[model samples]
Target: MWFLPDGAGITNWPKGPTELDALVFGHVFTILTTPLPNNQFAGIVRGYDNLIELCKRVEKDYFEKVLEH
Candidate 1:
């Protein structure tokens, strides 16, 4: 499993070989893809929208509970 930065612009690119890990830091987008028969690639999905919402909820809850003390 691997993670790409910003979903690599959400484009359908050709499949190739890579020897290095090309993931960037400070990004939380998980990419999923599939290879085609013609050496082309498909799928550049980025997820974790719900995680942002969850973080907001946790922050609100923490402030309401812990910060009040």
Candidate 2:
């Protein structure tokens, strides 16, 4: 797995050959893909939108419960 800093160039996914299984960059979660033309070797599993919703729901629930206490 590759844990890259946010804004790192991932379009040319993988960058090079290795035993990479997954990649986490910014709010994007990508998995290794069979190398293809255009340097496309990473497939996005989840993007910011999905993560935002999850975070929102969790925060809302936690805050609501806390306020009830």
Candidate 3:
């Protein structure tokens, strides 16, 4: 999965079909804005929050799939 928090980088991501294919293969991607009090220092906090949320969702989905099996 790819987590892009910068507007500029996110805009430039997936420059072509190859990148798009990679993105699709990754399955999950997020484009998030820096949270309040935005600054260079806030990136890590935002990234951590994004990762935690992603983990929670993935965990829930995994459990659901396992239960279904």
Candidate 4:
């Protein structure tokens, strides 16, 4: 599992695909310029199936190829 707090690095994402079993994005909205309340910084936890599927979709749509303009 991985916990990404506000302003974390994506450069290490490649390292994660193999190491992480469950990735947790913490305080996602808190990273925005208009910061949310500390209490509002919720954690999103996805299961294995959903995580794998999400990764696949991201790879297919964003990482794997260029879009036709």
Candidate 5:
């Protein structure tokens, strides 16, 4: 899932495809901005909070396509 805190990049999404398995995006100091959904999804942690909870497997894929866009 793409964590776009800046709300700038990550556009031109697929034409028809939905529900992506893998994420490609960016965030800046994500912990502060991303709110813990205070409604139905509130139970789920957010931002660095959530990242801390989930077992991370970061390979840091800096592909040209995502970067150039």
Candidate 6:
């Protein structure tokens, strides 16, 4: 719902005032609160530990099973 970006000021990632579609995207961090009923917000979380693993695999040089997501 609210987070600080690596570049600039704080961010509140909600496209609308509705309960749904609320997410925060930061350059170095991501924060999401108020879970959705469908767990749709799941897997969208970005953790610091994932940086190495993620940076190691780039879309330009990587492929995966469709079900991986």
Listed in order, each prediction's TM-score against the native is: 0.26, 0.28, 0.31, 0.28, 0.18, 0.19
Q: Scored by CA lDDT, what does every candidate get?
A: 0.35, 0.40, 0.45, 0.38, 0.36, 0.34
Best by TM-score: 3
Q: What is the lDDT of residue 60 in candidate 6?
A: 20
For model 5, give the RMSD to the true fold: 12.0
Runs with alpha carbons beyond 4 Å of true place in candidate 2: 1-47
Better structure of 1 and 4 per lDDT: 4
**1-69, model 6: which lDDT tens digit per residue?**
122223445365554222221221222223233455654444454354343233233222333545476
Model 5 TM-score (2 dp): 0.18
Residue 19 displacement in candidate 5 (angstroms): 6.0
RMSD of each: 16.4, 15.3, 10.4, 11.4, 12.0, 14.6
lDDT of 2 at 21: 21
Best by lDDT: 3
TM-score ranking from best candidate downward: 3, 4, 2, 1, 6, 5
Scored against the true structure, residue 21 in model 5 reaches a CA lDDT of 19
Ranking of models by lDDT? 3, 2, 4, 5, 1, 6
Error of 3 at 55 (Å): 0.3
Question: What pairs collide in candidate 6?
Answer: none
* Overall local distance difference test of candidate 4: 0.38
Candidate that beats the other on TM-score, 1 or 2, i.e. the better one:
2
lDDT of 1 by residue, 1-69 (tens): 023334657475435312222232112222222344542221222344443433344446444687777
Candidate 1 vs. true structure, TM-score? 0.26
Candidate 5 residue-wise lDDT at 62: 33
lDDT of 5 at 5: 28
On lDDT, the stronger of 1 and 5 is 5
Locate the minimum summed-lDDT window of 10 residues in model 3: 25-34
